[model samples]
Target chain A: MLLSNLELVPGRRVVKHLGLVQGSTVRAKHVGKDLFAGLKNIIGGELKAYTELLKESREEAVERMVKQAESAGANAVLNIRFATSSITQGAAEILAYGTAVTLE
Target chain B: MDLILQNFDLLLFAVLFITGYVAGRWNERRHYASIRKREDEFAGILVFTNRFPPPSTTRVATVLVSGSAVISEDFFKGVVAGLYSFFGGRIRSYESLLDRARREAVLRMKEQARAQGAGMIINVKFQTFAIGGRRASSVKGVEMLAYGTALSPVGA
Candidate 1:
């Protein structure tokens, strides 16, 4: 399905508004990475652990959002957005939302 | 009698130490899992957006996170304890959630633009807010919002 951050897709036309669709998830990874990250802190470089962790979570969140949109029978999702929250010290939550719409 | 008392004290100390260690490790794992889940979800949604086009007209979208949605009791407690950590403790988690929500909202807008036969989205904006107050039995919610204008491509 087509997804965009803007109200409307630049090249397509919205024919109908299906409704609002969204997906969210919470995740946590092993703390060994955190310790490794701490050691890397001294070197002042990128934390590969966090980077991999972030990438994984992002994919999961999007999968959920797309599923929601698909359930709504929307050919496209408009005005898509993402959000994150830490329910705890090491855990994080990611949310994706958009307006499900049919395009012509 | 003195030896017996010392033994009892040692046993108590061991139990307490074990409990603390387990609790600490559990808490850390919980946090890591939540973070990873969120990150994966966000990345998946972005891939969809990148494959799509931007919007052409103004539109708004929002996503929300509620306390009831959290399953981990310890994580919930951590949120409560976080209040005392000068808000930094839980801020990272909240930020990640909000970021994912915002990105998804933008993607939705782009979808709208494509539907409208627009070329690009313009004037995008985001907003966030707390909808519920802290309560022992109540769930708090955070909302993520995005808005923008969809543009049509030239000579299309």
Candidate 2:
């Protein structure tokens, strides 16, 4: 599977529109991490907890998006994009979407 | 009685510190694990775009949350209080969390677009909400959403 944000790939040629594809995931980190993050606040620095979190969430969403594209039999996906929503205090939703197309 | 109160404070602080440390470590571990798993999943996929898509084009794709995520009440309250203590003033930890979530989501989407061979993404959008109950003084979980489209070149 291929994914991109631009409508067209730099060198490849799109042959057909494979239709729309998307992927999403809902995630919740353990509370114990939150407690450590709170302590980090006192020391003052980077919020490693949240950094790790967003990273993981982003990967999951991308994976799902790729799966969707593959299922659609798309040779590539163009103009990929991501969206996130907070479902609750500990949980978040990550979503990825793009246009599935065939490449010549 | 004074001694007892002092001891209680000490115990509370210890608990808070330990909890915080544990939470941070656990969060880090989970993050690494998730990344590894996703990388394995994406190993076969290709990406093309590295930046945001240019404006002035119709969106060809979109993604949505379509669900809910909840933070533990205890964790939410602790984060709020921790932020207050660190900042020494009113701070919107929840809002910050929402904003971070949105940004991260968009970044991931861009990554996906790049993998798929797109030059840009557009039509980005966001939404947020709090699940159930009235607004309380303590921190509560919030839901944030981000969406957009990945665009490839016209001919390709």
Candidate 3:
């Protein structure tokens, strides 16, 4: 399935709108990674562990959203957007949502 | 020995301050240099915030592309920000942090588009947020994500 974060695909027309589809997941940092991050606070730089973790979470959310679109008989997901919220001290939720549609 | 024992906390604070100052400065300089060089290298690819791609006669395929970066504030920067908060003025140190995060995110998105043989990205959107910043005095970090649709000719 194709994905675009725009209202309409440039060269294609929407044949059917399958309404909104969304996926979300919540994750907490590993104890070891959190320990390393604490030390990194002293001499700050990129947080590779957290970055990778969040990236994976986001990809999973997108994958689930794609699955929903596929099940709905949609060929594409449009106007895709992402949201993130910290659930607690070490946990966060990543969400991916978009309008599912069939293109012609 | 008595003096050292009594001032152990002070000594550790001093050491952490010095290390943070020196290491954070060096890291910032190196990251800025790398960012500049890579930006120049990626100048050939076009990025835009327009909602729609330009009209094209040839068949083109479009796909979503995204990039994200997370950076933490050093002890020195956090201390500086604390001081700035007292004065009720702009926190200059954080400006650089946010700038770096945004630039890095955009660069990564461009890299992905390049890998996909896409010539341009449109409708680019950016999202920025603090990671695990709820607790007081916790190590604070900012995350920036850049996402958009990349357009490339169907064959190439």
* Leading candidate by DockQ: 3
- How do the residues B60-146 of candidate 1 rate in per-residue lDDT, one tens digit apiece? 332221111111122333343457466454555445444444544455545555555654444455555332235433223333444
Q: lDDT of all predictions, in order shown?
A: 0.52, 0.55, 0.91
Report the CAPRI category for model 3.
Answer: high
Off by over 4 Å in 2: B1-156
Q: After superposition, how far is residue A63 of candidate 3 from its true place, in Å?
A: 0.8
Local accuracy of candidate 1 as per-residue lDDT tens digits, A16-94: 9988888888877576765654333222222445545544675687778889889888888877777766676566677
Write out the backbone clash pairs for model 3.
none
lDDT, candidate 3, B1-156, per-residue tens:
999999999999899889989998888898999999999999988999999887652677898999999998888998899889888899988999999999999999999999999989999999997986757556589999999999888976
TM-score of candidate 1 chain A against the true chain A: 0.92
Cα displacement (angstroms), candidate 1, residue A38, comes to 1.4
**Is candidate 2 or 3 superior in TM-score?**
3
Local error of candidate 3 at residue B121 (angstroms): 0.6
Q: lDDT tens string, model 3, A1-104?
A: 99989999877899999999999999988888887888888898999998899999999999999999999999999999999998888888999999999999
* Candidate of highest lDDT: 3
On a 0 to 1 DockQ scale, where is model 1?
0.05
| Sort by DockQ, top down from the best | 3, 2, 1
